[model samples]
Target: MKSLTAGAEIDAWCTKCRMDLMHRIVAMVQSAPKRVICLTCNSEHNYRAPRTETTASGVHVRARNTGPKPSPAAARVTQKARAEKERADSWSSKTLGQAVDAFTRYAMDKSFREGELVLHSKFGEGYVDKVLEGAKISIMFRDGARTLAHRAN
Candidate 1:
């Protein structure tokens, strides 16, 4: 067995490419490779050893999973949808029954307080969730919360 270390090249199962390819070790755990980057595909992922099975003929064969697996893109889309729903729910709970005219137009020179409604030109309507130190405030908008400068000197 060859000595393994960070930056050493090794044969690893590339999850993205779904193949056994040469990889450069990027991270290590207790002298074992934890993460690697595929030299062929240029994709980085957790280090996985190539699976092999011994057949009845005593020959070593590469093992493969025949089951269907969820793709990374599909998981990302589902996560994005869930996050958007949560944001919409939060925005609705915070802004429910609030009059449009109650929102104060946002300006860097203007001071703001917590729970105050703000109308931003770019980020649309949002409410001041927290008044921070150093003329900063966390505002919750329809999309998400954003930190903005207020009462700038």
Candidate 2:
């Protein structure tokens, strides 16, 4: 590996020259490698090693944070929206046992074990921790904390 330093000449590919040309290191910025100014084309640009994170399957994995942060006012609106969505999505007035019953029946029909892994219609996704006596059961969800309910799937 070639170590780059200011004032040192390095062989860097020039977009204009279409070949590796000698370049002089000039300015460097934080979090990036040293800057390389092409001597032949007289152009300054930053150069970095081509890198990637690969999964166990050898597939490249890209991390992204696409969620937007909320400003104070925007946060209030978001909270209200979330509350409304919860109210809309909730099976209110219905007993949690009813949900468990429905989920268990579905799982049994599909040949899945009782209190197995499942997705919640509301609370995102989770796994059934265990089936308790009567209608109470425990569910471990992605949002953290275990939930005791009559049904979770």
Q: All candidates' TM-scores?
A: 0.45, 0.27
Candidate 1, pairs of clashing residues: none
Q: Candidate 2 on 120-140: residue-level lDDT in tens?
A: 566644456556664555555
- Ten contiguous residues minimizing lDDT sum, candidate 1: 53-62
User: TM-score: which candidate is best?
Assistant: 1
Relative to the true structure, candidate 1 reaches a TM of: 0.45
lDDT of 1 by residue, 104-148 (tens): 999988999999999999999889998998999999998789999
Q: Model 1 scores what on Cα lDDT?
A: 0.87
